[model samples]
Target: MGFCVESARVMLIIFNFIFWLSGVALLGVGIWFLADKNIVSYLEVVNHNVPNAYINYAAYILIAFGALIFLIGFLGCCGAIRRSKCLIGFYLFFLVIIFAGELAAGIIVAIYRTEIEHSVDKELSNSIKMEYTFANESAITKSWDTVQVELKCCGGKGPDDYMNSKFTNMSGIIIPISCCVLSDTNNMVAKDKSQCMNKVPEYYHEEGCKKKLIEWVKSHSVILIGVGCGLAGLQIIGFIFGICLCRSFKYEEK
Candidate 1:
């Protein structure tokens, strides 16, 4: 039992580090996205659009993951410090809980990405049809329903329309700007004609879009600090406790 506990401590430390590093990297990426003006530029490099909503949501989740690691690490450290079998068992159980949370989060994100991908496909189709008739006035101003023809079309209006919808729903504070749309220039299929000429100026200066982007940044920041700081603190405390637990083991043997 002594050797087994010792070995578990060592393994736990290794796994804890792995979790911490991953959490940090994700947090950093989220911060960069929030600070940068042209998020699309960074996202383009990664072959993603980095939707405002996803960024906000993912940042919070990453923080939570980090906190879990920290808590488990701290608990393991405490168990080692006191050489308490009860604490050690508890630590292990908490680690399992963290693992389950990670798995669930992964599944949630996967489903979200799949849905978003489908939406993108639908958006691409609409963009293509719109592109073929670009110069035509009738073709230029597509209706809200016309935009919704794409699959997985959610509660939002258009792509930009979705932006407004997100703004309205974000944190229960609605900042309404009726005429907005998300550009499809980033679409994989109709990449060239993704930018609707009419929507370019609006993209840069639209109040609704700007407000939504700002809100995205704010909400994501809360998520990052809440999760990241909490996790880091937990890990440090856990490590200290683990050392004490380890010493206790030798004391008990003597």
Candidate 2:
């Protein structure tokens, strides 16, 4: 085989191997997200009574997307191995579609992050003061508690924000135990119940859960963008190899 055909075949096969690994990683993450208690808590907030709930059922979406990627990688590998032009064409077509979709998603996220944050923060604040109640066993209550404890944060803005919530007026407590520096973070048991409940600054988390979440998202934005760029480059290279291989077929035939 000439350099073009041989090189293209090898490169495409390698690409498929890497793609398969990525699919497996995605699948694992999806499974982990579904099984994890913290992630389950996040689901409650994600499904808040809001239109365009973007991340609702996110674990399922990740699983489905991972499976599709796995299937495509398998098919692409087969095409490269067997030198099937038709299969290669189909592979390229689907890859292009995925590339476009992901690119658009990245663009949308970049353009809307600041603008969307305002509405999200507003909704979270409303949830804190208006919807939240202590020991209610409701989904919103549970989600807020989880966010407070797990994120090591207090209310939407801070512990004082609870004063406006039904949690304080009805329950007659200054702060939720979940806002405390918990002895058991997972179970929401406070390290010092008396001090924490009395609104002692030392025993409580000073930061706001909403603010912490926003910071976490911002901190990881660069990594997410880098990974996205890397994946796009991988797809682009695979597309190029497929094209070169197709041209080689005609070249060899001639």
Q: lDDT of all the models against the reference?
A: 0.44, 0.72
- The digit string of per-residue lDDT tens for model 1 on 1-254 reads 66655665665566556656655665565566555544532222112333434544554566566555566656665665555767776875675565555445445444544455444444433432232122223331232223222211222223343333333344232211113243442331222222322445433223222223233334544544455445445544544445545555656577
Which residue pairs in candidate 2 collide? none
Q: Which candidate ranks first by TM-score, i.e. highest?
A: 2
Query: Each model's TM-score, in the order given?
Result: 0.40, 0.86
- What value does the lDDT take at residue 29 in candidate 2? 60
Q: Give the CA lDDT, 0 to 100, for residue 4 in model 1.
A: 58
| Minimal lDDT window, size 10, model 2 | 52-61
Lowest summed-lDDT stretch of 10 residues in model 1? 171-180
Instruction: Indicate the residue-level lDDT of 149 in model 1.
Output: 22
